[model samples]
Target: MYKLSPFTYTFAGRSKAKKIFLDSTLIFERNDTVAIIGPSGGGKSTFLKILKGIIPEYSSGKLEGEVLFNGHPLSGVYFQENLQKILYLFQNPFSQLIYPGTEEEFLFSMENFNFTREQMDREKEKFEKLFNLKNIWGKKTSELSNGECQKLVLASMLAIGPDVLLLDEPTAFLDPTARKEFYQYLDVIRKDRLLIIVDHHVDEIRPLINKVIFVDHDGHITPGFFTKNNFVVEDISLPKPKTAEEVNVTVSDLSFSYHKDRELLKEANATFKSGEVVAVRGRNGEGKSTFFKLLSGILKPKKGQILLEKNGKTYKNDKIFPHVGFVFQNPEAHFFFDTIEEELKQSFRFLSKEHTVLKDDLLSRFFHDIDLKKSPFLLSEGEKRRLSILMTVFLEKSLILYDEPTFGQDQKSIEEIIVLIRELKKLGLIQVFISHDDYLIEKIADRVLVLEAGRLYEVPRA
Candidate 1:
């Protein structure tokens, strides 16, 4: 059986990431379908990167200990060549996708793996139907949404026939039905490959995993906590606020025609309250993220405006960001920090606590826990996800908007997020969540707002 032993990794020294977060005492062996779960700053992703031999090799970092492949210590080995059998599927499928290449170019990656005209047609018919990807096969990869792109990536990975597949929050953006379908496919996927999934939707995933490795904010990996037969269901208390009757968000006669297409938001009008958490859901190309952008001032509304009501004052467009903090699904996309600590500092600026006044103990604990001194960009997908959330939460804005916070979390980490959200809501921070997690809605969202064909509608409580 394959194995990894006494593994340790740290990022390039940066004052920002002085933390020595991960100290994994346990070893990972074959036949162990380990699910690493933990808080946002926890070292879940870092652990996976080290195992994949990306750390200190493809990446520049300080690494200690050896990762044994069948009792043979192969630490800092030729990671890419050695681990060809292990595929590290990125969190965002689009990032891994070569944008400039055509679909045919992408499909036939290996020069030798060619398709005879007939075989190509047959393969197309099967995969297109299987993945619902018929329409965009000839189009550019940039044209696809997060969900559609993910299905394509999955199709490609399955084709490679890897021995182990490491996925990061693979279903964060998919609808509940699509999310279910993806996991069901993974559980029965033809390969005997040991599956290491770092996901956030635990309710849907709990049944499939073999064992769980629970990690804390301190980056401690404790394996074999929960297994298939040892599943324990816990009732989580989340901070779901009472819905207010007054209109908090008003979209008045919002109409937009993008690139000569029909109106995206055709005179869409709606109202939201401070305590309400609305989820925008629809098929890809339906303007989910677009609606968020309109509200956040990245894209000005073509016709109508998203009016935020704060202390009885109606603020429009750019005026609302200060009142409401938005946590993008890819927080790293906007982060220009040289180190994690700098990013933390920037986030802390929004806090009521003075910069010098912020607790050093908490900072110390955070750095030590998350290993923040390391190169933040070099972190694994899951680690990046957590760090982004931690930065947003630290901002302590009146309103917090999360595109998809739980996308790349394992079952345990998902639960921890639920707990944290509940606690934050108890503090009366306005939360606007755009997510597909039914479990998250049940726990944290007091009201659900669904977007259909770029139109926004609210699902009232029964």
Candidate 2:
């Protein structure tokens, strides 16, 4: 059981200090399964850090009051004394993967905790079976997809058999089928274990969680089964494309493989037209991200060419960069500037004077609630995702690729993205996004492409 009494936390920002949790008190009973829900930058992750004693310990922050585990103070000593009984899985799973190989990453924690080789082997075998990680056993963690990394980290944490497991957006990168399987497995394993999850997918975790905690953007924390429906996504009007030239992207006989033994994509072909939103779907580690990289010239194809045709001109390979906008799956890795305002300014150089007023309107609408002076690194995962999408779309490229655009988004933020995607489609941009969010694809996709068995095929929308 865990209890927090009159806790408050604040982070030092560039221009000002941002208060996250304010004089909040909460308690979780043993064998309780709880879900924490909130908007972007609303302090859900901050709460988890505080619970794990990462606040004012690993990271600098102003803290007040105390967090107790089983009536004892949950601080630095608790981590070492508890025998790895309390585990916190970060939102970005890649950050936790220290080892290069998947198997090594799995056993790192157990080794550190002084588990015997026999015991470590047993735990690894059990989790490998449960997570179906056998196929990726010998691969490097760097080669695995985000979803794979998430699975590996979760399995390793579970392998230690923690008494209290705090998962921050555990399924943010998982595909639909994988997510369902994970939750079903969690439902079976969560009994008698104190499980606390922070996720934006409220409906998926609804059946598994008995208690809900709502953290609002204004530093108010409420514990209960509360319904919040007041935030509505407002529509914004964007100008049409300056030129009427038709644009399309064609992938011809594309073949790519990271290793020689296995072929990830082979003879994959797809054509996306302007004024349309196309969604790519596939299982995790099925090369969806690899295909995007090939499209963006980040990686070269083994035996094919990607061509962008627009306005009686053709651009090939790296030459297509100017006409293409990409929102990477990991937003933090793509950010080069210190602050949100600096990031936006970098994107502004690509805009035309005619679109200056439009950009102002967008800035007012999208960032009015957020502090631009704050470092983008200081923002929550969801906030970083939103800012990345906005910055990429600012390019107004002929072709745009978004990888998991709705990864950690709340309902309102997802709706806003849907609206923005529709507006981009109206501007005659060829938008192809890879997402596990079926709702997003259903709402905006003009066509759907499924990557499987080393080929791309068009799937009819349901």
Q: State TM-scores per candidate.
A: 0.75, 0.96
Task: Indicate the residue-level lDDT of 230 in model 2.
Answer: 48
Worst 10 residues of 1 by lDDT: 229-238
Q: Report the number of the highest-TM-score candidate.
A: 2
lDDT of 1 by residue, 197-310 (tens): 777556667777777877666555666454332223344333333542233666677766555545677777766665556656566556676777677666777787778776
Query: What does the lDDT come to for candidate 2?
Result: 0.84
lDDT of 2 by residue, 1-462 (tens): 888787777676436666766466788987789998877677888888877767766776778777788887766776567548789989989889899999999999999989999999899888888778987899999999999999999998898888888899999999888899999988988988989999877778889998888888776678858465546777877766567659988899999887899999999999988798999999888999999988988787899999999998999877888788899999997688878889989888888666767776666555436778778888888888888888898776888999999887777778888888888788888899999888888999999999998999999998
Which ranges of candidate 2 are over 4 A from the true structure? 22-24, 226-231
In model 1, the number of clashes is 14
Question: What lDDT is reached at residue 157 by model 1?
Answer: 61
